[model samples]
Target: MSDAASRLAEVETNIAEAARRAGRKAGDVCLIAVSKTHDADAIRPLIAAGQRHFGENRVQEAAAKWPALRGEAPDVTLHLIGQLQSNKAEEAVALFDAIHSVDRSSLVQALAKACDKLGKRPQLFVQVNIGDEEQKGGCAVADLAALLAEAKAAGLAIDGLMAIPPADVEPAPYFALLDELAERHGLPLRSMGMSGDYEKAVMLGATHVRVGTALFGARD
Candidate 1:
């Protein structure tokens, strides 16, 4: 098997083991290959191995890579999983299938405006600062309800909530909180977890896990 395929198999094994430990079916979790820094050459093998969804962090990087990668891996679905600047909102809406880091009203407004111009609206997830960490770029937990109401009012399709628990704490409670918030708001698709804590996320009912290092080895 090719190197990337081997790595993908290993990741699938880990994900399956995680699901088994969580008493959930492996198919319940979706593994989004975090291809932020990596290029098309690095991701092609995963595509060949049947990975259809990939995530990128930067607008410029995605813009640079998608044209070439899309032609090669026509079935791949791209997700923008990073903090998006308003100036780049139009390009991001054009390039990504979903935006998982809508943290502020301004960003949402930009996306709405961009969508209006494009005549297409990509799925959106509000990023929640469940840990209340000041450094993170997410709406404060107290603000989520109002924000979700605003997003709905703005004609945005609120797919779910995305979060990154404080790096220093256990992620389970935080993830569960996000799931609760999503439920309260009548939203589905909890996009949480990473290589380190994805199993806990699954146990807490994460529909989508953003796995990076476990699938790609270590990043530089």
Candidate 2:
């Protein structure tokens, strides 16, 4: 097998093992290959491997790469998994099938306005700072109730909650908290976990997992 194919196989094996250990079916967790900082050349092989969902961190970077990959992977689903600024909300709405970092009311309002003007409402997920870290981009856990209320009132379809636990912390508890919050708000998608902790996330009921390095090898 080629280098990319070998990496893909290794990732699949890891995911399957994680799922097995968690006592969950392997298909229950959707793998969102995070292609951030990588070019289309790196992504195309994964696309050919039947990976349909991908995530990117920057609007400008995705804007440049997506069009070039469009012809080769027309049916791929793209997700914007970074902090989306208000000025870029319109483009984000147009570019991604879901925005997984809607952390503030102002950003929600901007996205709503953009969707209203464009007549397209993409799926949204509120990012909760489960670790309560001061430096993170997500909203405080205490603020989630109000944020959920605001998102509901704004007519945004909140699929579920997303979170990044403290890098040094175990992810299971934080993933559980996000699952609980999503249940409280009647949302269905729990987009927690990354390459390192996705199996634990699946056991806790994560509908989606953003995995990059585990699949593509470490980024520079």
Candidate 3:
């Protein structure tokens, strides 16, 4: 019952059987338990085996372990999947509620001046290197429509489109080209897979699937 609650119920039963073979309704895919570099007692047993969406890849190691692990799991939803640094964009908009690498325009004008000096606007995602990987960390498949029109002309609340599809081949044609650039920028979230192709990124519509080593098994 506890290899991190049986690999978090086998990655939530393979993200509910890949959303029932893509008829799509296993809560339409959102399993993001990536807890980077594994601490907080290896992440409090996957938040006592419920795991309310956790991912971190350094905003000071999620400010050195998520404000006392989100003050003992107050519905933890921290994500900042990795690679961001325009002077830490106001400590990643005061610690991540989803910022999956908003790839550049001076880090979207330093996250729109830290969301206008810390009002906070976290759900952005632009990251699309899709396989044009010049050392990855996305934002140039023909510059994703001028980076989503410069992240919505700087008020920035994009709420979709991320990617990582070049490693070891066959990522469903780079998660179907980040689901065809999120249906050509009508954008309703994609944030592609991990842990060896998150059920092919939820059968290629991946509303969000940043799994880590199949729910925390391999990292350091």
Global lDDT scores for all candidate models: 0.88, 0.87, 0.86
Q: Which candidate leads in lDDT? A: 1
lDDT comparing candidate 3 with the true structure: 0.86
* Model 2: per-residue Cα lDDT over 46-66, one tens digit each: 888778889999999999999
* TM-score for each of the candidates: 0.95, 0.94, 0.38
Candidate 1 local lDDT, 105-180, one digit each (tens): 9988888889989998888899998898888899998999888878778888889999999897888889989999
Ranking by lDDT: 1, 2, 3
Q: Please name the candidate that would achieve the greatest TM-score relative to the true structure.
A: 1
Model 3 segments more than 4 A misplaced: 14-16, 23-31, 34-39, 42-54, 57-63, 66-85, 89-104, 108-144, 148-180, 183-189, 192-204, 207-220
Between candidates 1 and 2, the one scoring higher on lDDT is: 1
Candidate 3 C-alpha lDDT tens digits along 1-220: 8899899898889889988898998887888988888889988998999989988878998898799988988788998989898998888888888898888799999889988998878898888888887887788888789878887888787978888888778889889888987887788889898888898789879989988888878865
Query: In angstroms, what RMSD does candidate 3 have relative to the true structure?
Result: 12.9
TM-score winner between 1 and 2, please give it. Answer: 1
| RMSD list, candidates in order | 1.4, 1.5, 12.9
Query: Cα lDDT for residue 98, model 2?
Result: 89
